[model samples]
Target: MSRLTRTGQNVLTEAMMRIAVLGGTGLMGKLVVTAARDAGHDVVIAARSTGVDISTGMGMDAAFDGVDAVVDVSDHVTNNAKKAVAFFESAAENIAKAERKAGVKHHVLLSIVNCDDPRLKAFGYYQGKAAQERAVEASGIPFTILRSTQWFEFGEKTVSVMGFGPVALVPRMLSRPVAAKTVARSLLNCVEQGPSGRAADLAGPEDLEIPAMTRTILQRRGQRKLLIPISVPGAGKAMRSGALLPGPGSMSAGPTLEEWLSAR
Candidate 1:
C-alpha cells in the first residue's frame, strides 16, 4: 500500500521498501541514506567505504541482492573532459550491469540541469554527465533522472578551489542554486515513487550569479577575500547567458541563498 506525500509542490505516493544508495557516503548520498532510513525504508550504503565500489563494480552484486531501487548520486570531480567522461561512463556501465543481475526495479540518477546544451559543450563535466545519461538510456533499465541546478553549498566548494592568497577567481556564471538538503529529499521521493523517465528540474527560488553567491558565503564565514569573476571563453560565456539556470517548467524550492547562509 502507498500513501500520498509531498516534497514541495509535487504530489507523490510512497511505500516503504529496501533501497541501495551508490556513493552513499558522499554529500548527496549521505543525505539520501539518512532520509530513506528515517522514512522507514531499509537503506544500503553501496560505496567504497562499505566494500561496494560502483566505479569498478566490486561487491555490487551482493550489495544489491534484494534492493528494490538504487539511487546513484556518485560524482566525478574534474574539469578535463577526458577524465570526467572516463569516470562517469565506466561507473554507469558498472551500475547497469549490477542492477541487471540483481533485477533492481528502479535506477535513480542525479544529474545537472541543461548539461546537454550545446553551449555547455566545452565544459568537460557536463560532457561526462551527458555521457552518463546516454549510458543509462541504453542500459535497458527503468530509470529516473533528476537534473538539478548547482547547490547552495557549492559556493563554499568553489571558494576552496578557486581562492588564492587574497582573491578568489570564480567563473562568471548564472545559476539558480537549490539547497543540498532539498535535492536529497527530492531524490528519495523519486526512489519511493519509482521510475519516471525525467523528473522536473529542481532549482532554488531566485536566480543568482556565482561571484555574488561566493561573496555572500565569504562574508558569512567572516573571511576577507577579494572575489574576481572572470569569463571563460566557452562554458563561462554560456553560463553567463543563463545556460545553467532552470526553465519555466522546472520545480522551484527554498531556502533562498540568503536563508541558506544564515542557517549555516
Candidate 2:
C-alpha cells in the first residue's frame, strides 16, 4: 500500500485519524471540537458530560481508544497553589498515561503565551500550565503546544464574574486578546499539521485595554454598567503592560473588537 501523502509541514501519521478533545464541553473546547469536525476529522468530546474525568483518570482510556491525537484544555478554577498543582499533575499524568497506552501519535496542549514565565502575576495558574506543558513536552508522543493570547470571551466573562447588582467592574490592564473562535480555528489548523513542537503564539487582531474591552461589551449589549476602573497589582500589571501581547512574528489575525461585539 502506498504510504499516506504528507499534508504539509506537520508530522502526520499515514492513517485515518480520530481526535479526542480533553475539555470538549467548555467554551474553548466547544470551539475546538466544532473546528475539528468542520475540518472533516473524526472528533471525540472527552469531558465530565461525556463520562470522562481527566482530573481523576476516570474513563480516560476508553475515551482515548483509537484516538490518534488529543487536545488538552482542561482547567482547574482556583487560587490555591496546592490544589492547582494537584489538579494539573493528575490531569496531565492521566492524559499522558492514557495517550501513551493508546499509542496516540500526537498530543496538543493549549497554553498561555507567557505561562512559561515564572514571574507572571497569575503565577499559580501559570505554574500549573507550565507544569502541564512540561508533561506534554516530556511525553514520548509527538506533541504540539499552542501558546495563545487571552481571549475576548475570557475578558467578557471576567467582567460578568464581577457582578455589581447590574454594573460590571472592569479592571484596567493591557491585552492583545483574540476571539475564542479564532483560537479554536488556529488550534484546528495546528491539529491538521499534527505536532510542530511549539507553534507560533496566537494573539488578537489588535491591542486593547481591559477597560476598553469591557466598555465595548457593555455598549454592545445595550446594558448600562458602571465601568469602574480599578488598579490591580502583579499579574494585572503584567497584563496591563502588554505582557500578554505576542512578541514579534506572533499570530494576530483574529476578528477586531468592533467585530467581536457586533457578533455577540
Candidate 3:
C-alpha cells in the first residue's frame, strides 16, 4: 500500500514507494530505475549483473524485502521457442512466488504489443511474452501489463542482426518506434497508479516502414549496405503485414523515430 496522508486542506499526500526493478541494468530497466528514483521512490535493482537471477529465483527474496511493487522488464535474448518459453515462464513464476511472499502490492510487466495476436503465435518471442502474461495474471497478485510497440533501437538492432556481408535483409514491416524513455515514463505511471490489469497499449507518434527505418539507420551510421526487402514466412509475414501495430484504446507518446534519431 502506498503511504498516503491527508493534509489540512484535505489533499492526500503521496507517499514514497520502494520499487524493485527486475532487469534494472538493461537498457529500458536502467531508465525505469532512474525515473523511479527521480520521482523520489526507492529502487531495488534486481538483475543477473546485480547478483539476482529471476529465472532461477536466486537472490529474489532479499530483493523483494519491503518492496511495494515489482516492475519486471527482464528479457531473455533468444528467438528459439523452447528457450524463450522456458525462460519467461521460469522468470515470471519466480517473481510471482517471491512477490506473494513479500506481500507486494503491485506487479507490473512490460510486454510487447500484439503479443497475443494470432498472427504472432508462431513467433517464439511473442509466445514467450504471451505465456509470461498468463503467468502474471494467475499469480494471485494485483498486476498491470503495459504492452509497448517496438522501440526506436529496434531499427538498428534489426539491421545488425540481419546484415550479411554487404547486404542487409529486411522484411517489409510497419512499426511505430517509441523512445525507450517514453516507455519508461509510462511504466512509472503504471507503478504510481497501482495495478489496473492490462493497461492500454503504448505506441509512438508516427508509423514507419521497417526497410525505411533500416535505411535511415544505415545512412545515419554512414554504413553503405545494400538493402534487400525480403518477404518473411510464417510469423515474420504477419509482422510484415502490420499485425504488431497497436489497436484502439492505446496511449500514444512522442519522440518519434525521426526525433529520437535526431537527438541521438
Best by lDDT: 1
lDDT string, candidate 1, 1-264, tens digits: 456778899998767788999989998889999998888789899889899887789999999999899999988888788988898999999999999999998999999999999999999899999999999988999999999999988877877888898988888889999999999999998987889999999999998998899888888899999888898666877899889998878999999988888787
In angstroms, the error of model 1 at 79 is: 1.9
lDDT of each: 0.90, 0.80, 0.89
Residue 225 shift from truth in candidate 1, angstroms:
2.1
**Better structure of 1 and 3 per lDDT:** 1
Tell me how far the alpha carbon of residue 91 in candidate 1 is from the true structure, in angstroms, after superposition: 1.2
- Arranged by TM-score with the best first, the candidates are 1, 3, 2
Total backbone collisions for each predicted model:
0, 2, 0
Tens-digit lDDT string for candidate 2 (1-264): 113345576655443468999889999999999887766678899999999998789999999999988988778876556677677877888888999899998898899998766457465777678777887788778999999877888756877788677677776767788899998888877777878998999988888887888777777778777778775545666766766677887877768988877777
RMSD of 1: 3.4
Off by over 4 Å in 3: 1-12, 164-167
RMSD of every candidate to native, in Å, equals 3.4, 4.0, 3.2
Can you give the lDDT of residue 162 in candidate 3? 87
Clashing pairs in 1: none
Return the number of clashes found in candidate 2: 2
Which model is ahead, 1 or 3, in terms of TM-score? 1
What's the lDDT for residue 154 in model 2?
Answer: 70
lDDT for position 83 in model 1: 88
